[model samples]
Target: MEVVALVSGGKDSCMSMLEWGNDTMGTDELDSFMFQTVGHTVLQSYAQCMGLPLFRHTIRGKALNQDLHYAKTQEDEVESLYVLLKEVKKRFPNVQGVASGAILSDYQRFRVENVCERLGLVSLAYLWQRDQKELLQEMTEVPIDAVLIKVAALGLDPYKHLGKSITALRPLLFRLSDEYGCHPCGEGGEYETLTLDCPLFRYKIVLDETEVVIHSDDQFAQVGYFQIAKHHLEPKADYDASLVSGGEGIVYDVWKELPDELPQCTEAEVAVDAASTTHGELQAAEPLDISLSHGAQAKCRGGEHRRVAAGPTLCRHKG
Candidate 1:
């Protein structure tokens, strides 16, 4: 049976892909699917590296405001996922099943299942209810090169997250889970991730460029902001997760934080060309150090201006 896995370049999604090769479903066959979001380049690149036939469904982050405020109610989730499923149906006309990397969030699972029921797309939760600790261990064992992209939890700071390697983050996540009740793999939305290089990827994603943007909230003490970056894939020279750990990316802060609607970036101008050479090697690269901004750009330590038009302004910050 042709299937599409809702990949996020996280442990669960990678596990789902690896599971496809195993003869668990006997005669049932497998295919791959990915849900693309603007900030999730690592996962998208991972899918390309793996040579998976991917169908991307775009969802505006702002559209999730209602769900975020209302706790992802059934109606909210169903409506959102319905849009995604409809797009998937158009691409894979005969898709028999839709796989997810869902682990413990019943809210997330229920929503996906509802979409599948509506579209006649079987819902497969391969990583549901498994031991959280064990799952983290497996992620390390498989050694997926994932990095934390956003952090909204107590124990995790933007510094702890932005450019840290997944393996480095694991022990801290484990400690957070043990002490502060944080979800081990951030299932509770404490954080989110992006996979750069994984076993399933055909080529490693190399991040060539980046910029920082703020998404602040009045209600929260620590406002939310993220580093946006561009990635490209290239053939693997030698498979080593640690080699790519150094290029984990950068972080910047929000100044004069307000609760206004976050601004969007100018659309990425680069096109994906299969023949593109590795733009920058990931081996032994350094994490980007950027200062907070009050107006249009973030000041980077390297003396280069990282532009952020109407997104975040650097005004008085010095580079």
Candidate 2:
């Protein structure tokens, strides 16, 4: 069915689009619609990359006020969104359903349902209350570029959110949920994200202008950044330098700096403990050390070492 998906550039929205994939060619169902509330440029970049037909609504007045105030309930939040969806429904006369990225939010679901009822549009929320840890792990396995656009919760260095890959952040996210009260996927407004490249997008987004926001106080050390501009995606034989890291067609030799053997007690293990970190932060900054009778040995996974003890203190691994 042709549908208008309310995409937030988050995992749930992106994954909802992927659900349209069909077993056979030419049988794919669902036409996607993306709307950007505040980040129009980011959405535009995404549309150009994914080649999707998008409808943009400029958010202002009451809606903008509510967002600025960080309104907690959906009543205030959806007042503006409802108006936007109404306009979108008219554009797609054949739309049978409206898609959303809502997960674990009754307010979000109820609001979407209310809007759909008014427009005779079906509400599709594929992800709601799924195991966040599993959901996040699945995201890492998927082909997508999830980057942090906003981080307001405790323990999240706004700096870490910017330009960080979702895969690299998964372990950290798990730790945050276990150790701190922060939501694992930022489902509770701990942070926000934008997917730069994905299967749904035809082109990849490349950031051209970005500025970091620094909030300095005696209590916190953090940075936040936003994309001001990005490359205009157009057909070209060669990839743009600003878009591709390490440049297009450039080969990376991974073996260039790899070590043959790691000094060790032998095998290495990852506990995968969410409790070790909070808000995507590893609790302990110190590395695990292997203490010996004569001395102590601290060796990183890649073989970097510091000898805390004097005697024959072999590392956790030999490199």
The top-ranked prediction according to lDDT is 1
Q: Candidate 2 residues 168-273, lDDT tens each?
A: 7878878889998667777765555667665544455666667555433224424243444554554434434332222121111211222322221122221111
Measured against the true structure, the TM-scores of the candidates, in listed sequence, are: 0.60, 0.61
lDDT, each prediction? 0.46, 0.45
Residue 170 CA displacement from its true place in model 1, Å:
1.4
Clashes of each: 11, 22
Candidate 1: where is the Cα deviation over 4 Å?
22-38, 41-47, 60-80, 83-87, 211-225, 237-319
Candidate 2 local lDDT, residue 116: 72
- Which stretches of model 2 miss by more than 4 angstroms? 22-39, 63-79, 215-227, 232-319
